[model samples]
Target: MPVTIPEIDYEAVFQSNPSAILLLTREFDIAAANRSYERMTGAVGAEIIGRNLYEVFPGGADPKKAPGPARVRASLERVLATGRRDTVGLQRYDVELPDRPGVFEPRYWSVINAPVFDTDGRVVMILHRVMEVTAFLTQLRQAHDHGITATPAEVEAMEAEYYTRVRELQQANEQLRTAHALEREIAAALRESVERQQRFVSDASHDLRSPLTGLQTRLEFALQDASDDPQQTIRSALKDAERLTEIVADLLELARLDAATPVSTEKVDLAGFVTEELGRRVSRVPVSLDLARGVIVDASPVRLARLLGNLLANAERHAFHRIEITVAADEDTAILQVADDGPGVPAADRDQIFERFHRLDEARRSDPGGTGLGLPIAREIARAHGGRLLLTDREGGACFVLRLPRSVSTGGDSG
Candidate 1:
């Protein structure tokens, strides 16, 4: 007797496979789904099969506002038209749970759609495969909550890993055609993100290291001279610590400004505000105020005060004998100017002066205590109020002009 051979059942293998998979007709209607797909979507085969893809998984809360359906349909149509496989990056899809009625759970998936052709070389069905990556995204979010910063190198590695998997999948499905335009766009965005992260890290590290290095050097010198007055050494270390604190505070302020934090705005009396602020500061330079009365503007008082203080301090540091303050308002904009009697900023250096951590050689040599963040912070504050602070040309010294919109008001003049 001849031995009998058993026939292979490929349909049974597909139905029992662990990976979530769906078979769709040429019309994009679900034809069959594996056990894993049914479990993943919490839908019975009887309920989902023979239904349109979008009908089964409605895109988002608002049909008109969502891009999910269009994106998925486009990929499927591409596979049907070209008889090739298509891979999509991460997608956000919320699913309704069978156990919980009227409730949808957020889910993310990486999907691949491949064509299934007939004997005549015509596509008849689509094989849709999905891998759930919600847990991986959740882990990344949790790491952010724990104050873990991702480096540019780490981001590049993650992007490379994603494309490597995509390449492998394309190789496995030799008929797959990669979307070159989408790939180029993603690469450009990732490159930009990496560049921004690198610049931030470099600037932050440089700013932080300067004061720390000074503190270390001071401590070392103190240790070397045991007989010298310990109080003076302690005072010097305290000064360095204070400087570090100021740098950290400025950095925080810059971050907040960059984030566009909301500010409180109110009508401020310009003349009185300037008078009160000037009274608080004591400088050897002769200060003159030529303030116009009834000059008022809508601004955040705290921010305005800080801006003015920075300008005044800068002028005082550079002034040889006199510092002048002027306030005037026209029909549309209010103008405030601060002028000093020292060397004016060079035309070439004026543009770079407002950059964070930037300092002129002469300014640095004269004012060693300056953290080089004051002018930048002032400019940001000015911009936050829909205004501008500019370095205007002056004959004898640097002149800073602050322009702001005039607020509606009625008041008396105070010179």
Candidate 2:
């Protein structure tokens, strides 16, 4: 006797799948959502089905304060534009508690978004899938509270990456401070010099205290735990030391800038210079360049390169899909603009962005490696070379505009 096989229910399969999933319309309205998604978000399917994605779980009062929604929106837009899948790795997007109206609960998610193409090859819907990783991240946070630790091999890799450069550069800081003491002393006789010096000392002291305190705490922990792995303690100490070295190095660079160190100037082709800089950089986000030839600037090649690097680094910290760079020139000024598609700077904080040791909360949350001095350093370099760097207004993300005096003698070939 032959048995009849039942037809599989596609909707049943979609709804029963253990992973949290949602189907969104082209306009980002929730068309359908799975039970797992409902469970994960603590919302009923009825409440979210017809609402827009952002509306369903609004990113707090100040949208800028909550980067999760912006990132999600960006990823979805990318999928719609490219007709491909995009993955957002480990995002800290908090979810609103269903019981408590305005209060949000901390949540971490690993998200993947894919486009559902129609017969005409247009994206009709987006398949949004998310895995909640809050538990895993919470565990890691708890571990961090105890002490920083890494494997022996990891420590070796970090040392190879950070220690060599630090060792070679660390001595220069002390030497510069000692040799330039008299110069600083003479300058301190100026009107605002005393206040400025005191502020610098205070800022430097505060920044240095963090790593020093961490190092001391880790050593004390090692002393307390007789059974603690010596290698673990050493790794932790090395991590803090590396952080200290980085701070010191940045401080030294700022000191050199403050002292008005003289550097050699040359006729550089702006377009070609940017092209070379792009080649040396490795970025996760795509970069688009628009280079106009014959744009020349009289600049110190090394210092100008550093300024460009800092701008690129700042863009990388916030950029979502792409970073756009353009080089052009007017009759008297050479212009270079770097723009990103990430969230733009808030109006109130625009000028303060270049202040030393000032970092936006989002920037600090996203990038732990930054010294909060990149923009300030870039501005200083620009000023030193008789140029100016400004965070100009852009639609989607932030745009950094660099304008330098065009060189009268344009002798260099395109490069």
lDDT (Cα, 0-100) at 32 in candidate 2: 96
lDDT by residue (tens digit), candidate 1, 1-415:
9999889898999998998999999898999999999888888999888998877887555545665456677789889877888877666677766786656677777789999988999999999998988677566545545677876556556655764675466455433344565677789998986886677668778877887898898788888988868898789888889988988888888888877999889988788799989888898799998999878889999889999999998998899999999998766678899999899899999988998778898789779778788999999999998899999999999999999887856444433
> Candidate 1: which stretches are off by over 4 Å?
1-197, 221-225, 408-415
On a 0 to 100 scale, what is the lDDT of residue 86 in model 2?
Answer: 78
Q: What local lDDT does model 1 show for residue 248?
A: 86
Query: Which segments of model 2 are wrong by more than 4 Å?
Result: 1-189, 411-415
Best by lDDT: 2
Instruction: Give the clash count for each candidate.
Output: 0, 0
Error of 1 at 290 (Å): 0.8
lDDT of 2 by residue, 1-415 (tens): 8999899998999999999999999999999999999888887898778999888877675668886788789889878877879776566687777778888887877789999988999999999999997776455445534666865555456545443454345345435644776677677677477787788888889888988999999999999999999999999899989989988977888898999989889988889899998899998899999888888988999889989999999899899999999988766788999999998899899998998888889888878656788899899999998889998888899999999988887633333
